[model samples]
Target: MHPLISAADLRAWLARRPETVLLDCSFDLADPSAGERAYAEAHLPGARYAHLDRDLSAPKTGRNGRHPLRDRPAYAAWMGRMGVAPGVPVIAYDRQGGMFAVRAWWVLRWMGHADVALLDGGLPAWQAEGNAVTADVPAERPAPAYPDLPPAMPRIDAAQLQPRLGEVQMLDARAPERYRGEVEPLDPVAGHIPGALNRFFKDNLQPDGRFKPAEQLKREFEALIDTERPVVHMCGSGVTACHNLLAMEVAGLGRSRLYPGSWSEWCSDPSRPVAKGAAA
Candidate 1:
């Protein structure tokens, strides 16, 4: 199945099956409380809120990156609480393009859910399509049947990535400025991981913020990596990197591995090398 869903398809799906689950994952890293407030004020009917820091991530110790991936069993319980079941379709959306939504999608895939997908173009697209927004929160339904199988997705850490830096294709999903070490807004360190090529996550989106066509993405990404080096993605704290991963899947490229410890964790320790001034 495609990793993305259109607003019209979502409406049709919900009409046919009211058991379809919708997740609102709008979040602002600058203000942690903003997403919750936004969901409270207004959101899609029957959509449950997934907080970036709270529901989506595990507790951060300073060592773990900003939004660490929740461990499997705990994550399974969380999904059970969210009403995910064996055959139910899960749709995730965010106000900021597909940034946070893709994270939910990727994590759901990792948790072995096959029917999960992102709301392409996100909440804005839904509103533009004339879908009604409501403040009504759906009553909680306990789905004890949510699967807890081993990860279907791939992942790597700084320890495993450091040794193979030169051998693998490490795509840094940060912005150009951040990749070039020009800014240091979030992390203490400015530069990206050494031997990493810059592939800004936003490049996957069209001018209107929707994802570019699959053919275009395939062509661009094919040109970016000339060799058969294994692909690994990373961003500020492994959040936006999921956007790139989702794009690759959309482009018919199979799911690639992710460095969950991304730049934030790599820079936390002074031992890891940081590179500056464009793709290396």
Candidate 2:
């Protein structure tokens, strides 16, 4: 299956395999609890709520950025508990135009699961297709255990990315203002990594909340960053960066590495250089 699944296709999949794991990854960075509360009100039938701060992220230690990854074994255990064993189709969706769903997709892939995909347009599209949502949550069945394998997703950290600054194509997924040091509501530092280009994660979506065509995404990405150099994606605390990576896969650009620590980690270190203003 493709990285993105249409609402119609998702319904079809559910009909054939009722045991498929459908995850609702709705989140609000500010309130944090808002997502789960909303999930309780209504969600796709059989959808399990994946909390952003609780399920998908590691506890922050001030230095590792706001939302570092949970250890591999710990993450695998969570997946096992959620019934996401090998070959189980996992469909992640979010209310925010897949803003949080992509994170689920990325993390699941990082955990060595290849059957994960996002509900292309997320909750809005699911409802728009006349699919009924339910307030009742499904009980998570324990999945069979599997051997721990090396992580599949590639990553870069501050220590590894600093020296290669201009040599690597760093793409900052934050909004233009956040990237430009004009306004920074999150991270303490109000700038981006030097030589990093700004391409707001939202730009990857069409006006209707669905992702743009794969060809359109390919053109936009090719025009933004040099294809010759290595590409590493980042956002305020590394959460939104996965959206771009997912977009690239949809564009068939192959996988790229993610700077999981991202800007939050970069700015935490007083020694790292911070670039302000727009892209030069």
Candidate 3:
């Protein structure tokens, strides 16, 4: 099954199988509580809310980025509470161009759940289709224990990534301006990690907000680096970078590692080198 599902397909699935676990992973870095507030206002029918700071990320320690990956067992337990169990078909969506949704998708995938997917184009696409949105929250199911499930995805830490910079293709998923050191809105430092190529996550989507065709994504990524080459994805706080990773998966470009700490963590240490402007 593809990593993305269209709104029409999701609607059809919900009609027949109401047991499908739909998650509203909408979040805003500017105002963290806005996502839950928006969810309380209106969200997809039967969709449970997942907050980035509360549910998806672990506590900040001055070392990790703004949104660090949640502990494995705790996250699995949270997923269980959200009605996502082993073999359950989980679909995550968000309003902000699927940025937070892809993070949910990646988390589930990393937790050894192969039946997870992202709602293509996210909440906007569903709303655009004139689908009904409800304020009612779904009832929680009995939480299941997530045993030692080996991760299916690859991830690299800053320590492991720094030395491998020249060995692997590091893709920075931030905007062109952010990658070029033109703006520093969120993170303390502007510029990106040295040797990292800029590939804005938004490029994966079409004007209509849905992801482009697999062939198109394949062509675009191929122009940057070989499909078979080892690739590591990063962004401001390791959020939007998941969009790039999902795009690569949809493009059948094979799996890639994620630098979860991202730019924020990289810049936290003064010893790490920061590159300005575009990739050479």
Which one is best on lDDT?
Answer: 2
Better of 1 and 3 by lDDT: 3
Give the top-scoring candidate (TM-score).
2
- Runs in model 3 deviating more than 4 A are none
Q: Which stretches of candidate 2 lie over 4 Å from their true place?
A: 144-146
lDDT of 1 at 111: 88
TM-score of 2: 0.98
Predicted structure 3: lDDT = 0.90
lDDT of 1: 0.87
Error of model 2, residue 270, in angstroms:
0.5
265: Cα error in model 3, Å: 0.8
The best-first sequence of candidates by lDDT reads 2, 3, 1
lDDT of 1 at 105: 88
Give the Cα error of residue 102 in candidate 2, in Å.
Answer: 0.9
Q: After best superposition, candidate 1 residue 231: deviation in angstroms? A: 0.5
